[model samples]
Target: MTRVLLLGGTTEAGRMARALADAGVDAVYSYAGRTEAPVAQPLPVRVGGFGGVAGLVAYLRAEGISHVIDATHPFAAQMSRNAVEGCAAAGVALIALEREPWQAGEGDRWTHVPDLAGAVAALGEAPRWVFLAIGRQNLSAFAGAPQHHYLLRLVDPPTDPLPLPRAEAVIARGPFDVAGDRALLKDHRIEVIVAKNAGGAGAEAKLVAARELGLPVVLIDRPLVPERRVARTLGEVMAWLDG
Candidate 1:
C-alpha cells in the first residue's frame, strides 16, 4: 500500500525511477514539463505542476500517495518547497534526493558566488570572452554585465536572439566530454566560465576542462530549499522508503 509520488527532472530522478520500477514499487513520476522532450522514465509519468500546494494535496489524497520523493533539479527550490508543504499537509512521508555540491580541487581557478547577482557582479566591467554554461533560464542575469562576450552552450536553439550585446549560442545535448569541452573553450577564446554548481558527471566536464585550461570560473551557489528529510544516493532513497 506504499504508493508514492516522485517529483522528478534531474538525471538522478531517472535512475531512481528505474530502480523503483525494477523493485515493483507502485510510484508515479511528476515532471515540471520544462523540457520539450524529456528522457522517458520507467515509472508512470505525469506532466506539469500539481497547480500548487493545494492541488498537490488533492492529487496525493486522490491517488492515495503514501510517500513523496523530491528529485527535482538543485535550483528548483520552489517545487521542493511546495512538495515539503503539500506532503506535510497530506501527512505523507517525504524525502529529498539531493546531489552533493561540487568542491574546488587543486589547480582550479574558481570564484564562488552566493547567487546569480553575485555571479554577474564577479564578471566586472571590463570585457572578457566568457562561457555562460548556466542554462537559458538564468541567462538574463548576464544583461547586468554586458561588457563581457558570452559563449552559450544550450540544449536547443533560442527562438529569440540573446539579450547580451556580444554573445553566441551553440545548440547541443550534454554528457559532455572533457576533450570536447576543452576544444570548445579554446575555439571560443574563452577567458572565463560562468556555471551553476550543478554537481553531476553529465555536466561536470566543463569544470574539469576549465581546470586543465587554467580558466577562472564564476560558480553560482545552489538555492536553499525548505528543510526536509534528504538522501544523497539512490540506495539511501530506497532505504528511506523501506524504513
Candidate 2:
C-alpha cells in the first residue's frame, strides 16, 4: 500500500501536493488550521490537528496510510515531533521535507538567537521600531519586552487586542518581493526584523530587504526536532516515496 499522509503548512508542502497530484499518487494533505484561508491542495485535504500522537496513530491506522511526509514549517516542531512518534508506533515509513536554514551573508546584519524569547531579549531596552515576522502564536512573548514598537505581518488579523501596547498588524500573504519589503520597512521605520530562519523563497524577501537597508535581524534558530529521514526538495521526497 502506497497511501501517504502529508502534514503540510509550507511552500515545500504546496510543491509536494502538486507533484503528488500530478503523478496520481494516493495521498492526503493536512493543515493545522492555523491560517484563516489556506491555499487549496490538489489532493484530498483535511484541516485541524490529529489531536496528538495518539490521535495521529489512530488516523494512520484508520486510513491505512503507509507513508508520511512531514512538510511543515521549520518552526512547527511540536507537530513534527508528534509525527515522528506516531509514525514509529504505527510502523509506517516517515521522512521530513525541511528547507535549508538561512545564513548571514556579506552585507547582512544579523543577531542570531536560539528562540523567540532570545530574540525578545536581544531587542534591548531602547524603544526601536521592530518588524516581528514570526506569526501570531509567538506574539505573546513580546509583551514582556514592551519598550519596542512592533509591526507584525500576518496572514489574518488578530480578533483580540494584541498583547503589545505599541504593536501594529499588517494583514498580508507572501511570495513577497524585495521592492515591496523595502518599501514596507522604510514606511514603518523598522529598525530591526525579528524572524525565524524558515528557509524558502516565499518569505525570504524580508531578509534581502533588511540587508539592503542595513537593518539588523534578530534571527531565531529552528527548534531541534527528532532525527528522521530527511529530504530538501520535493523531487527528493517524491523519489523516497517511489522507492
Candidate 3:
C-alpha cells in the first residue's frame, strides 16, 4: 500500500535505491536529466523534471505516491524545494537523505563563501592557477574572473566551448582518489581550488589533496531549502520508511 518516490542523483541516492530494491519496496527513482548517462538504478526510473510544484503534486496524486525520499545533491536547492512543496500539497510524507557538509580541519586552508557569487569575488584581481572543482553547470560564473587559468574535471566532455577563456577540462568520473588528485594539482601547478561543500568520501579526495599541497580552497556553502525531515544513513532512512 506504500508507494514511494525516490528523488535521486547523488552517490547516496544510488545506495538508497539499492536498499529500497533489496527490501522490495514499491519505489520509483527520478532523475533531473542533467547527466547524459546516469547510473542505472534498480527501481523503475523516470528522467526529466516533474515540471514544477504543481506538476509534481499532480504526479504524486496520480501515481499514489505515499512517501518521497529526496536524495538530491546538496546544491540542488530548487528541486529539493519543489519536492518539499509538492509533497506537502499532495499530503504525502517527505524526508531528505542528505550527507553532512564537510568541515575545515587543522592544516586545511579554506575560504568559505556563502554562494557562487561570493566564491567568484574571493578569487580577487590576481590571476592564479585555479582548480574549479564545482562541476560544469556554473562554469560561466568564473568567466567574470577570466584572468585565472581554471582546471575543470567533468563526468562528460563539453560539446560546446567553455565560457572561460583560459580553462581546460579533464573528462573523468569520481569517487576520485587523493593520490591522483594530488598529482593532478601538482601537474597543473594549481594555486587554489573552488568546490561545493558536497560532503561524503567520493569527492573529499580533492580537498585532502589541496590540504596536502598547502593550497587554498574556495568552498561554496550549500544553499538553504525549506525545512523537512532528514535522514543521514541507510538505517535511518529505512527506519523512517518502516515507521
Q: Which tens-of-lDDT digit does each residue in 1-243 have in candidate 1?
A: 899888898889999999999999999999998777888999999999889999999999999999998989899988999989999999999999988899999999999999989988898888999999988888888898888899999877888878888889998787899999999999999999999998888889999999999999999999988889989999999998998
Instruction: Tell me which of candidates 1 and 3 scores higher on TM-score.
Output: 3
For model 3, residues 69-187, the per-residue Cα lDDT tens digits are 99999999999999999999999999999999999999999999999999999999999999999989999988899999999999989989999999999998889999999999999
Q: Which stretches of candidate 2 lie over 4 Å from their true place?
A: none
lDDT of 3 at 148: 97
Best by lDDT: 3
What C-alpha lDDT, on a 0 to 100 scale, does residue 129 get in candidate 2? Answer: 99
lDDT of 2 by residue, 1-243 (tens): 699999998888999999999999999999999998999889999999998999999999999999999999999999999999999999999999999899889999999999888998999998999999999999999999998999999999899999999999999988899999999999999999999999888999999999999999999999999999999988898899889
Worst 10 residues of 3 by lDDT: 137-146
The residue pairs that clash in candidate 1, if any, are none
- Residue 97's lDDT within candidate 2 is 92
Going through the candidates in the order shown, the clash numbers are 0, 0, 0
Put the candidates in TM-score order, highest first: 3, 2, 1
Better of 1 and 2 by lDDT: 2
